[model samples]
Target: MWRTQKTLLAALMAASFTILTALDFCQSTECQSYDNVPLNAEMSTQTVTSRWKNVSVSNTVQDMDYFRVSCKKLLEVFPVDVVDGNFVRTVKNCIFSKSIPTPLKAPLRLVAVSKDVIEGVLDLDLSVTQSDHFLHFASGGKLPPGSVPLAHRYGGHQFGYWAGQLGDGRAHLLGQYTNRKGETWELQLKGSGKTPYSRSGDGRAVLRSSVREFLCSEAMHFLGIPTSRAASLIISEEQVWRDQFYNGSVKKERGAVVLRLAKSWFRIGSLEILTQSEEINLLRKLLNFIIKEHFSFISSDDPDRYLVFFSTVVNKTAELIALWMSVGFAHGVCNTDNFSLLSITIDYGPFGFMESYNPKFIPNTSDDEGRYSIGAQASVGLFNLEKLLQALGPVLTKKQQHQAKMELEAYNIIYQMRVHQLFRAKLGLLGEEDDDAYCIAFLLKMMEETQSDFTMTFRQLSEVSPKQLHNRDFSQMWALADVSSHDLFPKWIHVYQHRLRRQMNDSDLERQQRMKNVNPRYVLRNWMAESAIRKAENNDFSEVELLHRILSFPFVTQETAEEAGYAARPPQWAQELKVSCSS
Candidate 1:
């Protein structure tokens, strides 16, 4: 009986030891929360100190820990003090929480990291492994000290109707960080987890959509378009059920997250939210913060500061739409909320570059009305700007409002001028002429009628010469196009030749080279993106890496034979690929 009692005591002792060890591990590694953690708590000194000591260090032996600790302490104590004084003093109504809800599952693998963005923007020597860890912590919903995330509230016009309180449903904005150049950038995690605004969403981003965003963001940046930059991509083993088509057919998919870096995430909808809620004081304060943070060059002391701000926004919007038109890019959802206040492309859902030169192409399957079609983007941009102007009603005087309207009226003229300039560059026309617009119109009309490949057509034009018009190569190229038998085709070419002749300083070769530089040989074609997605889903990441390399230098011809397939016309099956806002 004594021996039996001793064995029970021994078993009890072992169980107590295991429980103690687990409790210690939980304290040291993961800080699981039962409720929403306060943002202030997340930015506390002790919390940041613990994270600095626990997180993995990089290979660079330059005392990065000290740098990180110093930066974190500075941000924790004086989050806005480092920013321009105007912003720190004026901004209000921002939601702050100590700790955001963590993802359902931790990141299992590091998919990709945009090294160019990290080296160029962040000025950090973070290796892929380090980046992976950082992304997992920041985007996987792991809240460490100095990593407090903010979710901004906003309203928007969706499909020409008001969408109230549509804020960052699954996005969390981590505090801003200063780069080596002293430029401050806001880092945001999309598909991190649920927020107050996630009405019915699971708040998880699937791998398919995550991959699309990761590649497209980099592709647009390299294409010389202003867009939010992607830093890293992380995938989780957790499964997320999604009705990809919103048709009630739900399926489980792999979850993922993307870390997006930008100058600011403020949008027109942010202001609209304040105005619509009758928060006049908050609206004015937020406007001041925006100007102070992003447009510091425009002095707040000036009497016409608001008017000047409106005009600058108008100009930027016009230029952005013109750029989109030049590249045949259709942003499937041009909702006011998706329209960045700084005029950079933000969300990447359902976006498409025209495979054919059809101006009426609509990429989003949900956009049945074709309101945001390629042909309608410019008009929609102006429409959204008008909504922004309305949101500023509380701040502007009647006279100033009239002035804002006048500035808004200049959008069409500005858009036309920018479009002409872009097309001129594409055609290698050194001098602007009265007939240039007509020539461009004719070329576009011909392309639309023939259903010719938009990118390839311009690229091929660079190789054609006046002397080769009657040759077999030119005949073959012309045959490939849906050319009309009418004499208008030859007439347009005659006009084009006359324009080329005036550029005596540039030889044929120089002109071709110039055109090639402006016209990209590669775009993130639907087929290519689909192939990358499929391969990634199957655990083959080689295609994603290869596509990244090719897209990095889009304007130059890739020397490898493998790239030949990417440059060719997409397979017929590519036509059935549908992308929607859910993407």
Candidate 2:
């Protein structure tokens, strides 16, 4: 592996440095850098003709001026023969003619002819067009017809237990590249149709789920979390089959293809499942590749390379979980496939940020068991990383693996510590020790008792006076709190207040910025998304615009009451708007 690294570095750095000479990149639209070399250029050329025009552009991420999409690369990825007939574009569209602000919006011009697979992105905007779908069908796009690039694999626990066989099903990674900022990034397409792992399924993504993944990923990035960002989202209205719980009766399948952009779609489960194969060595090879691609900062010769990898990943997972707690996010389906090595929120299926503070709340309507509820996510993340460690254990010496296990085991401690620190910071407190943990748990208990607002609880606490802490309403909720028998919670708040008084920062604005960043004034409230969904379904994009605007500046205070709707919890009716499978 070290020799492989040394041999790969020259070629990799060379490609990566050339403003992104992506290694083995194949798709022309996404894999423009040298690393990306398309296999089906002959078929791609046929999808394009002089008639393709720009359709709808993105709305949320209004930053469209920064990109230079590669059209020639797009030609190489899909088919060239069907270009004239179906109009080559770069996505398998599920959304009709809707506009949502995309994070990296460039003109998404396309050739709009309905076909089996039309996916193309010319040197322009990252918007969706009909032609991309045609290319998917034209190039024998059910699965690319060659030895496909290996799944960037890793191991992770599923539902607190470890089984194997987790690889990309509806996902096919395009490649990785360095952007203009010298930032190394991954570019992979979700719903790029099926792959070898489709496992008797239609391997398509729906637009509804696609939009959620796309927007939420970018939002996490903007919020200073280690999150996968959506570069583009394309929707083709062609009917695809997926399961729908019918009329409170017949539960059957329906379908759609929603193309998504991600930095890296590689998952921990991808590694573990492969371990059960004769291809364990292949798993090792993939691990080496991951080390090279994402963990290049670590020195391979360092006796603690494996330990350091585990530590870095563990810390990242902790921080990510803490951030989710701050904003009240629940990754509805946090199975191995969605547990990216990068630890970013990858799949956005049935995902939601909390409005009211219900620690046990599960966002995925399909998750009857609450496996991915918000309260359990931290534990789940730790469990997943442990599974990863189990897979990587053999790669290092037994001694190294033991050391790695200790480092990984500390994830919960670091996570709880950070989470407590955030809660303190939200209250303008500058310090606390393990006492912080007690207070955090108590606060959660209070939130649950009052059916209190998660964001509002923190927000209002920013200005909480000593007198305010003893409010009759607060007292009633505190009484209902079913937290542990320890009186440590109420005791800690008193200690925290005095601590804050002594260490009050020099600048209120500085304190304000710190608190605001941690505690968002707006989240992607379930009610808000549903409101937008209802209106958007009827051809209205206004609610969508409003929700997008607030989420973009999640930490900001709205200037108007109308804009303040994002802060409210979902009403009972809104809560009942069930989302089964995405799309």
Candidate 3:
């Protein structure tokens, strides 16, 4: 009996330590609340409009004085490659290459800017973004005063095959900025021209893809998902040619650049290159730097720190993928290089939000085999984690390697648990029931059979009353109307109603409010992005600006979004829209 009691106490201590470690990580990063918005739903329309003006433009615009100061923490702390020129060749023994951005041609246009990101994250006055100095700096025409631009070197497995030395071809890490909040953000320029990683291809991003990345980056943030943020999108008259579908029909499109920010750009591939090249010493140095900077909760002196870091990454990666599933988002390219080591969503390309509830939905036209579909993301996540474990093999002992594998084996359980928790919150289920998982599965199956819209079906359920659901009155809820057409929907509704009755303390209004907070009314649908992109290509950024503002508060319903048909059924032309890996 004493032995069993002692074992139980040891388990309790381990669990407590895990909780404290998570708390420490959160404190270190200063976690951003997903629910906070600039506008309040309870306010009158006039008041909301008045408050939006104040919130968006609260700070005065200033000159470019703030651009004089920049930090080089990565350069100061690590060794760079000996090769200094922007030549295409294999690089070794470096975390980054010193590459200068080839400036975009003149006649640059500032298309879109995230005012909230400027004011909140950068702690800069919004007016500072108005000058041509901001445009030039963002587009690589002129570097910030103290910026030391560099390109990250990494490798990844594309689809299922190992693609070696797939580093930053067109991106240049400008410098790091530490804001008033003491949060450090690494700023990078996408489409800032070529580096050593550019292999026979132009190192520029076209306007078509740049607009999508900009809008979706901000949209994902407002949805409460952990993601890289976009500060500005600038377009230029420089021509870029692409065979968008590899069909030999090349076309000329204008170049564009986006200034994006993230805590760290390191991914599983960052270590993969070092391991594959047998750079064990450099790998160890990079690993220690990551732990010291990001994973401070794990002591640098601990011999088992690598194992602990692997475990933390495994748990957070699972949670991040679960959040993606909850929102019906498919990363499209789930390659190891694109998966962030910090567990935030990064490298937005060919991504799509599921319109119809098909688990087989493939967003990237380049994915002919449907390897990175919506339903396959969780499994692909496991595959990437396995690759990550392999990358850490050189540094880990035999016993630690086994422990890391054991931690990886728990990924599916962790992912499913987070998914269940998030879906429960979406359905406003206060307490547990034996049938909760079954209920969620049942509704998804029905949605699949009926081809119901994924985002709106859950959103309509939140807006609907129990009486409406029972009476089958879905006249006003088009998404629910599509769902209710299924004969089994009645059976599912009965099960859901019975489940709701189990909530003792939650009133209908409280339940509705809870559900509404999680179920967003709008997501960046490909069609919506296409519409905005068409106008953006013609130098009409009105739609792009409007979409950004509306998506800033995705949970709250707005009159402009309604009038613009953002919540309506997608147009027929949208079915022909295709996104590939061209850009």
Candidate 4:
């Protein structure tokens, strides 16, 4: 009996040592696959279900379709260029160049469609989207009945210098459709083909970049950021070549197109080009038209309508950038042309959502100087606003121009206020306190030092109660565990708890609910998009469809998302990923 007891003790000791070794291995790089242990794995489905609001991915499609079958409405309203057909030349005195989309000659395949966007926004039946007519129309293979395609003509300040005649080189505006719901949507085909502005380049978008644009556009929208919508992504056998990294190594890639939707695509460059070309009369005409159509609140009779329009844009732009920061999104290209006058997320290229909290994170490989990093987006926004003010200089009175500059100056203040509100909500801090800002700053500093996952850090905080946080019990909460590794983490936690207690009658449950709403559990991380794109390039769009469905409700915890390892630590290969302005 004595020998058996000694043997049992020895076996127990050996078991303990093996478990510890395994845990240590998981903490190291060799166990990257299990980076996040999903501590709440035991939580009941009911508990998880209660956290998310029921979001319908698609509305019930009606038997009848109300899609406008042509571009006649837009053509009738806007001024046409003097030149009639597609040719590379300097365009003058026109809002748009009358051009036709050169259809893809190869066979087209409808890769994916946003049923919600079709039924909700366009008021079209879901059945209509599956038809050959829809496929051809979306891919630029066939024009809609009575369609008259037009390419917008605008110049821009590309990378802080005047880039003349940088208009819609590869996009054709297919026309405007006013849905039954009384909303107007402009349908445009990106990668449809060349226009007069397609200088020295083939008017095409490759599959890899097109996939990113399509996914990111829809993802941003569902993330509650204002953005242009993507109705469908179509792929074709048509071959296109691109030096993806701008290196000498060019590769063959399949051509693709996205049928994108927007209320209006008139950007700051719209006015800049007219002002640059000394088309003051046309500039004023365009401004008046925009004001009348989009800014109904600004009276057409008001002499200072342009000033009011400028002020509204400045305010909206500030709010937009603040929201982008809250979600850790970097647009990658914040050029004057890309910054929409409507203050929506447009021209999605080389964009990325922040994974690790690095201020100097540049998503676009072409952006060597880090001009459009996530941290610098707000400042870049100000620069773009300055260019916008300059664009409006020709139309504004001297006093109004002064007022516009003043509005531009107020941008930083407005942006800071919005950021403060958003970050406070992320921390689940109720009401204001003197130390709230400092506490928030301290937490962010610790997160940066530890290289914490930006999205999951806040999300994990939302998941854990104040008791767990106080006890430093971050087992299986991977992002929080990373952040807690900081030497000063305890000190920051004390400040945060003190600030949280200062709020009157804010229960832990209430705080959790508030934080969960603002802090999304998922974001379209670059690695996830890269995975989807790889399968898409192989003519397998299952992941694309899955990502679309998952991203449509990013706040929810779906079983499929968990099984797919989306919220898990990005795979090792993700670090080698690179995005450029090639597409």
For every model shown, what is its TM-score relative to the native structure? 0.84, 0.69, 0.90, 0.88
Off-target runs (Cα >4 Å) in candidate 2 are 1-157, 160-164, 245-259, 433-435, 463-497, 504-510, 581-583
Candidate 1 C-alpha RMSD relative to the actual structure: 17.0
Winner on TM-score between 3 and 4 is: 3
* Per-residue lDDT of model 2, residues 1-583, tens digit only: 2232222222211222110001122343332233343322222333322112232333211122222222232323222222111111221111011111111111222211211111222223233233433234211232222212222323345555554443455554433333322343434556654544444555566545555665566566656677665444443334555454433553222223333344456677656655544445656656665666579998756777667877888998888887787677888877766777777777777888765567677887877777777877776777677777866766778888878878876775677556655666776656554344444555565556556667766765543445545331244222222221235546645755555556655355565566776777666666666666566545465665565555667677787523455544346787566666544
Q: What would the per-residue lDDT of candidate 3 be over residues 304-422, giving only the tens digit for each residue?
A: 99999999999999899889989999999999999999999999999999998887788999999888888778778888888889999999999999999999878866776777789
Error of 2 at 274 (Å): 3.2
Positional deviation of residue 136's Cα in model 2 after best superposition, in angstroms: 9.6
Off by over 4 Å in 4: 1-66, 69-73
Candidate 1 clashing pairs, residues 3+ apart or interchain: 37-99, 38-97, 38-98, 39-97, 39-98
User: Among all windows of ten consecutive residues in candidate 3, which has the lowest summed lDDT?
Assistant: 17-26
By TM-score, rank the candidates, best first: 3, 4, 1, 2
lDDT tens digits, residue span 347-461, model 4: 9999999898877788999998777777778777888888888888988889999888888878866776677778879999877655555666677777778889899999999
Ranking the candidates on lDDT from highest down gives 3, 4, 1, 2
lDDT of all predictions: 0.70, 0.51, 0.83, 0.79
The alpha-carbon lDDT assigned to residue 494 of candidate 1 equals 83
Error of 4 at 49 (Å): 38
Which of 3 and 4 is the better model by lDDT?
3
TM-score, candidate 1, is: 0.84
